[model samples]
Target: MDRSSQCDEPSSPAESPSPPAAHGENEKNAQFLTGLRLYGVLIGTSVASFLISLDTSVISTAIPSITTQFHSTPDITWYASAYPLTLCSLQPLSGKLTTIFSPRWTYQTFFIIFLLGSLLCGVAPNSSTFILGRAVAGAGGRLSLYSFGTILGPIMGGALTEKVGWRWCFYINLPAGAVTVATLFLFFHPPQKKPATPLTPREKLLQLDLLGCVLFTASIVMVLLALQWGGNQHPWNSPLIIALFTGFSITIIAFTIWEQRQGDSAMIPLSVLLRRSVLFSVLFASLLLSSFVIPVYYLPEWFQIVLGATPLQSGIYMLPSVISQLLGAIFSGVLAKRIPYYNPWFFLGSSLLCIASGLYTTFTVFSTPPAKWISFQILQGLGCGLAAQMPLLTVQATLITSPAQIPLGISLVLFAQYFGSSLAQSIGGAIFQNILASQLEQEAGLDKTQIQELLRAGNAKVRETVAESFPQSLNAVLEAYNMSIFRVFWFPVTGSAVAFILAGGIEWVDLRDMASSEGSENRVVDEFSKPGAKQGGSRAGV
Candidate 1:
């Protein structure tokens, strides 16, 4: 069992304080050591982060090419879904895994896996094969990479689309990953292993919660599958959807009961869940993530349908938002150190995102001002960056006193965001796509066959339209696109409102209390660090 996954220490409702270690810390002076050296870890993490974030958007430009190559929407869609599916499901497990394996090795292991997966993805010969590769690479995909890539997506998109071909985006990881692996090996020596006393056999056997783990797994997997296939494969009322949803609900309930019953030995410690900062951050992060994700998922479709840009060109246009996200993460991390009152950054960010989403809600037809679109996105991007570290910061402030749950706690917050996104994108996509299809049918007097043919035109599809009169058909599609996008903004606005509410709720656990609690927690985090830890596990936040 991954140590990070099954923590031995009491995670919440702080157990009776054992004798403070001779040198043990207290709430007053928790682990400031990690915070002091935040830059070193932050910088290294940023490099890895940029690579991952770059991957998400880099593919946005290539979806057309992917659809053209794969010749199926489901296949192309799998490339995106597969990565998140695995990434989301395994998040909490990583916390446990890190405990057993140690952070340096844990990070290195995933980095290698992601890199190898990227190589296979870039060279895949068939759609199924490519999807398999994407799944592998995205399996336990790194979080920092996702944030960094999102931050610098604009730069990467420009470089990948303009200077090189779209496929190279995946291929680009080869050198970067190599350098990262080599650098870590060369420079990052592991901290001396503190001699941990062996666990009693009874303790080990008693600690296992296989039933809870299995139930949690079932809950997330069922939900994600339902979301993926709900609208596209089966109608909302279909038996398959109902069965899947039913399974999801039952499993989730079981997992929750199992966790609460299990307590300290639970898959996710209850104390962690009850922690005000961790709890609020996870909720807010989940809501905010919906806003961030819909744009990435839908904007490409909008660009292709409305802007008449190529798959690659659309990728470039979406770059600025990602660039802004990177700046936000770095700026916020630095700013928090200077300005002790952290909620303002989150407030400013959520407010800006709300404003942007509100503005987008009133978008015009294809003739809407480009500046307006760009500006709102930039504002949205800024909000994303600002909020990036705040939730994590909140966890450090209010919930995780130990380094043991630090990464796990971090993963939980991210998992929530992804969970929210998965739900939103799957449902939201259905709504937008369904709306687009119906509106297009009304506008284009064209039948399904004609629409399929039009969609097949892709980057150069319109230029090759069989009928020169296709623009009339396109009008309905564009009109639908405009309205659907308008609807999409509501998700962000509502999410922002929720995030703002949660931000107000997190208790400001002082940083002084962090080091001691962190040290104690780090001591016990040895039980749970599976790569598949919290991916889609029982916990909504994890």
Candidate 2:
């Protein structure tokens, strides 16, 4: 085994070392952090994860305040979509950068970027600047606390919005991020594997595949722009919309071709992506996330606009879903660890989510019972939590034999998740805005100017104004909002159904056996320093 051969191609199963030899190699390769340092590192990473989750979930409740202050309802989608746009677009580049550079320094750099973006958002004077800040923050964001931060984000966002202002939502990250950065700098020291061959800085830069990143990012921007503008800011058949879609198609095709040609050096390696488990994982994750993200973004709006709840009230109202989701995730993890298969959980979760989404369409401006809405939230949350992490687990298990490919595999799945979220939010926003505008005009007799005014006035102002001025149309206005939100809910229903169907395609493996045998020769750590280490391998058996 020599370094040159290791870089050339992946080794086959027959070339793997024996179990005893592998155990010895694993011992030699393992890096352990003990005592206070280990605990410090764990706390640091957990706080960082919490910050990411907070950034993601905190904005939902504060969106109405932001829109009101900026008086730009048209830019609501951008507020939600912008962050995910850059997050997904630059995800691969971040991964490549970490591999090429020191992980600690790279992490610090990203943290600094995120902090700066947060500052920009906190001090933003307009919608455009705020959206730009979100995009910048997203480019540096990648981490989560599973469900704990999710449970607190809305509550904290609402409290800050009511007591201080919506700007505090971004400002809140500053102190927290500073502490997290300090903790990580002092305590976290990850083991880095040197490359098989030393390369110049130019060579390392080239490995980032900036062209592929540009093409992929361009393709995403084109489609998002089309979604944002079509039938909202511009006519669906307008030249700009048509051109955007056309560009997306062409750029995506070019990205695919380029990626194929690049082979292992590609941002998303075809050698890992084409596997049955990994491909299914990517699709399942994307669709499942779409189903989950729609409710996370829109449910607060439903509470605020349709039901006339304040921001703080809406955050409290979201507790059922968030708490249930956390419970479901913990339950699912426990069951999956004990069970031999995870496909059943996926099927069950998707079924619950599909049912919940369908049920959400039945909500109206009046006469919906608390028990019904509460139960619906629980069902949707439980469904999302149960299935959300299975795809990652599946990918990791499948790629255990090809350790070097694990990170790449995980990154692709995550990219799909974020990309799906961005696309879904844009589509959902478009659906809600377009339908609400049309329905308000037809049913409530509100003109475009009045509608814009009503949107800018905030929920409380809108209620007072409508009751005082258009008393007879107040019910109609609320109904229009309800109908529009219900229509948006249908997208999640479709997404959940598609995920249910895709669950059949996910190849199953006995995780129990895999865990038990992980220390054996089959579970090789494909280190770059090793001469004969396998970079990729055949798909894990079903």
Q: What TM-score, computed on C-alpha atoms, does each candidate reach?
A: 0.76, 0.88
Assess candidate 2 and give its TM-score to the true structure. 0.88
Best by TM-score: 2
What local lDDT score does residue 139 receive in model 2, on the 0 to 100 scale? Answer: 81
Report the C-alpha lDDT of model 2 over 102-125, residue by residue, as the tens digit: 767777777778888889999999
Off by over 4 Å in 2: 1-40, 143-147, 187-197, 458-461, 510-542
- Candidate 2 whole-model C-alpha lDDT, 0 to 1: 0.76
Residue-pair clash count for candidate 2: 0
Show model 1 residue runs off by greater than 4 Å.
1-50, 74-78, 102-108, 125-129, 143-148, 158-165, 181-217, 327-340, 400-408, 455-472, 508-542
Compose the digit string of candidate 1's lDDT tens values, residues 1-542: 11222221212101111222233333332323244244444455556656765665566556655655555543444655566655655555544444444456767788788888888888888777887777677664643334335534544554565466556878888887776677655544444223267656565445555566578757876776676666656787899989999999988988888889987657666767777778887888777776677677666656765677765567667766766766776676666655656678768878877887788776766577778878877888888778755775566445343544554565667667656765665556555545555655676566887666655554324434634646655566557657765776677788787788778887655444443554643543322221222321111111
lDDT of each: 0.60, 0.76
CA shift at 479, candidate 2, in angstroms?
Answer: 0.9
